[model samples]
Target: MDTAISPELATKAERDDLLTLGVEEEYLLVDAVEPRAAEAVDAVFAEVPGELRDGVQHEYYRTQIEVASPPQLELDELAAALLRLRSGVAAAAERAGVRLVAVGTAPATGQNARIVDNERYHRMRQRFGDLSPGQGMCGTHVHVSIPDPETGVRVLNHLRPWLPVLQAATANSPLFGGRDTGYASWRSMMWERWPTVGPTPYLRSHEHYLTLIGDLEASGAMLDAGMLYWYARLSATYPTVEIRMGDVMPTADDAVLLAALARALVGTLLHEVRAGIEAPDVEHPLLMAAHWRAAHDGLEGLNIDMATREPRPAWRLLRQLFDYVRPELERHGDLATVTALMGRLHEHGTGAARQRAMLASGASVGDVVDELARATRGEPGNPPID
Candidate 1:
């Protein structure tokens, strides 16, 4: 698509410490009895404090709600802020006779469920019909702010190969449609039917991105730039690269770990680009293959090397990648927490693994929903919410 950035922009002197972080989490609003997204965010919003309420917004379906953390330099603080916001939202939902559950996809969603009736959502429904129905998927979005558009594009390009590893680490959806989907991350496969919703094509520059967006706009393939729902893409609105890979984490600790890894990777890639080293280019075809593996097997999948196009066990590749980015995580002060949780994720398995184990042992979807609710609330028995 000829997305090369101009030479002048690429050659400009790099800025120092060009990365900041933020997070966006989507949640399902469930009726206390059933684990499904509830159409009650508008009512719940009124109960949250104004200061803690600004960035909270509705999702494609009224049944889902989203909260965004303020931009922060400290990863731990960012995680805490998100947890606080989540707690507030949950409490408000409870007061309104609804509850909040954090998971990639709700177990009880169906085609008969209602979509948010806003102009934008209605337009999308009109355009895509049942393809864009209320799927009740929840996700955690990590934002790494770059110094400029060129750097954003560069970091986005370089990080494409490692996304599947991160996805495997955070795999949390083992059930969908009130039964086992038989995929580690059912959410990963669920969103692929949209026009531009998977791993994006590699772009060389900001201009290249502009051209692609321009083409999508000109061709009416998308309503505007906002509809280009790539799994990992450079944000046109915020000056950040958004990694929409992970599921809605099962616990706050898992969420923090995902954020730490993402920020470290972005920081390291930016450092490498500034040092005039060529960023590693993973084969796009291999990345697509690995993504499918991550969706099906989660941590158990055999990940293919993007450069060599050779298969390796997901655990082995994840550990190798962690070693390479460990320095960056250390420098950012997230090393200990990130490393600890990486081990925990491996030992306990991703959310998908945990959910599958729970179900196989006789827990129903309602039980899974209750567990997710407790995890989100930072209850005593559960791991601390991030």
Candidate 2:
């Protein structure tokens, strides 16, 4: 097999066949001088340039903003769109006299952890009560085009076991309230406080998926389909499977790496579904274990491998994912880019590790947030201590 992926290889970028993908990243706004979350989304969103305004929008919280890339077939095009969204939003936030930081949760909490003043969010706050207080979390959601709901459910099944590895790779919330939270991605811990936010169950078909959504709604576990916050799900509004696995990463490069992997995973599984390969039927309990382990250790420690129900180094699991999706990645002209990004991930550690490194070097929480602001804008930060 000519499996090599290089500049000379025939890539999907050079062909017409490719899967379309888009990325949605939520960011925290912090006072440029203070360590706490800043309620500046209104100002920042107003200042976003007209060209990029369509992609930039407010999230559930006034302290956060979200940017979504338009669907694109080529990895290069997707990367360019992400760069424009991140840089443009960063510039807008700065002009609003706030800093844009991409860590999954704010390093310090303030009285300003409030939701956007809208009717929908107001109802959410009333319904969820204290569960809504921790709603300040941010995440990176990747949407890959799918043909139909039936195949999208099958894709979700294949995606479940690998979701932990994705979470581990992008864990970025290590600090909260001016202290190390012990968990690598505190955002994951915060998010799971909601009734519907957890591992996606293996589905029998598209009907099964919809049935569960209706059940959750009737039971008050969720108010609507949009609140079915599984780690992966069929998008309610788009013809795409949304992978809501990772914490918001620190840089556009990190986000693009994840988006490429997600697209390749969906493509590989779509082929497998057509070939009659059974999606791995991992149990829900084990899936939950894997997610918790990943959030606790990020990429620097053991992950529960569903294949054996035993722990393996997270890096090894990530490599196994690359091997499984190598063909699809090469087909999409992303193998080389994925290869290079993995090297960087290995060298720099995850966003969580990098933030922890700054603290180990005696930087204050305010200083850590400053470093995150630089990284969020795609500026390089100091190397990890480990």
Candidate 3:
């Protein structure tokens, strides 16, 4: 017997029929003059209008704020939303006498005066100890809708080896605690302290994924599905696979490029799964090491090649990644934009390299922040110097 779709199911099914995209970006609220982390997030939040209130949010730390975009179809639409959100949040923070800077970690490493006054956040601080308050990092998260949990799991499985490639392209945080951490993404170092924050091994089926989540809940490391903080996971709140790698990019262009790559990767992997392609048999340790290399070296030196599991220059890996997903990009009409962004990233270096270059040339931490601030406002900050 053939089954017919219910009206409700049809309505819900329509949403996942196409690949919709969403973005979540986090920013650090800092003292306008001294560039120290400031506790003015509350005031800044108050300035957001109620109509624009749904997307603007306070994060785990008092000095942090986050904004999310609604589902979008075109890359330009998402880009516009991000720009508006950045400017909106920037205006509010400015009114509060603080500036909104888009780096992964706080420039000053001093302890936060207070965490977000939420029960869950408080519990996280208690559970994680010093790791919670010590972190002031932010990230750019992209959510791409999948037809179902089964497909979502498959997408995550195939995405494992490539997450580090995305991380390297978006590595912007090279400084933390008023000093060079000597790694491109110091925030990632702080983030991995949580027991559940890195990439996960393959889940052969959706049932296996649910079973694993149940086990994690039984172990009490996580309160719920929301706490399943893999680098990429099926979003509990949306019918989407959220790719949560990469630092929060300083400019809207970089953020949109990340989103496009994420969507293309998910779409390509989903098609491969439907075509009966097997997911890569990658070991979990290898994935973790790949992530570590990208975090430590960014894109300037070497990175782990997902195809061969061998060391290669970061740029070569990035090029290989683009080739892997070229078909999907062409399908979505994003190849040109993605290619242009790739060229720009390679030419200018990853965000971490750009930040280091400024600092290396006698630019103070304040100068670095100023340049990042300029980029956040859609102005071309300092270009990559030779």
Quick one: best lDDT, which candidate?
A: 2
Candidate with better TM-score, 2 vs 3: 2
> If scored against the real structure, what TM-score would every candidate get?
0.91, 0.94, 0.93
lDDT of 1 by residue, 14-108 (tens): 33343567788888888888876667877887777776776587888777888887766666777688778888888988888888888888776
Give the clash total for candidate 1. Answer: 5
Off by over 4 Å in 3: 1-17
Model 3 lDDT per residue over 1-386, tens place: 00122355446436544477889999988888876888888999998766568788889888899999877777887888888888888888888998898889886666665888999987877776776555477998999878889988888888998899889888988888789998999889888887779996689889999998999888877777888888998888888898997899888888998999888888889889899898897898999899999999888878998777799998788888789889988877789989998888878887788888888888888888877877776766568521
Give one digit per residue, the lDDT tens place, for model 2 in 278-343. Answer: 999898888898999999999999998888889999999999999999999998889999999999
Give one clash count per candidate, in the order shown: 5, 0, 0
Better of 1 and 3 by TM-score: 3
The TM-score of candidate 2 is: 0.94
Best by TM-score: 2
Model 2, residue pairs in steric clash: none
| lDDT score for candidate 2 against the true structure | 0.86
Task: List ranges where model 2 is wrong by over 4 Å.
Answer: 1-15
Question: For residue 237, what is the lDDT in candidate 2?
Answer: 79
